[model samples]
Target: SQTIHQWPATLVQPVGSPLSLECTVEGTSNPNLYWYRQAAGRGLQLLFYSVGIGQISSEVPQNLSASRPQDRQFILSSKKLLLSDSGFYLCAWSPLGGRQPQHFGDGTRLSIL
Candidate 1:
């Protein structure tokens, strides 16, 4: 069975500070990994996606970046967080080339102060 883990379930940071969030998957290999952010009352917006190791696609250019350092580890980072950066950050995974429903870990809810 495949499972995903993401942490610091919630965070409060001052504006202009740096941010780093991590996600990892177990029981799967070379799965498609995605980072999404959901603002208050808005739909999930794709931030980045990785098809394989060292391969990432950015869906938006904002105050955020993503990286895949291992087969199952994905990271989201920001150099200087903005108040607009505060939201629900989610990590999801799907089987390679299959239509399996994407599974999400408990999201990181960030609030900028």
Candidate 2:
């Protein structure tokens, strides 16, 4: 079975600090990976996605970026953190070239102080 792993489970970072979050998948290859951020009660916002290695697509213009350095690895990073960046970030994956359900990780709860 395929599983998604994301970490750190929670984080508290000061404003203007650099940020790095990683997500990895096991038992899958060439899966479509996605990064989403949810603020408060708002719905999940698509931040970035990759259909293959080194093929990242930004869903919106934001203060963050994502990279797929390997077939089953995804990383989200920011040069400087913002107060608005504090939220629940989730990493997910679905089968490539299909409308299948995505498997999500436990998520990372980030708080900017």
The most accurate candidate by lDDT is 2
Q: Each prediction's Cα lDDT score?
A: 0.95, 0.96
Per-candidate TM-scores read: 0.96, 0.98
- Give per-residue lDDT, candidate 2, residue 41: 94
Q: By summed lDDT, which 10 consecutive residues of candidate 1 come out lowest?
A: 94-103
- Per-residue lDDT tens digits for candidate 2, residues 1-113, read 99899999999999999999999999989999999999889899999999999999999998899999999999999999999999999999999984999999999999999
Report the lDDT of model 2 for residue 5: 97
lDDT of 1 by residue, 1-113 (tens): 88999998999999999999999999999999999999989999999999999999999989899999999999999999999999999999999974778999999999999
Error of 2 at 60 (Å): 1.1
Q: Give the TM-score of candidate 2.
A: 0.98
Candidate 1 Cα misplacement greater than 4 A, ranges: none
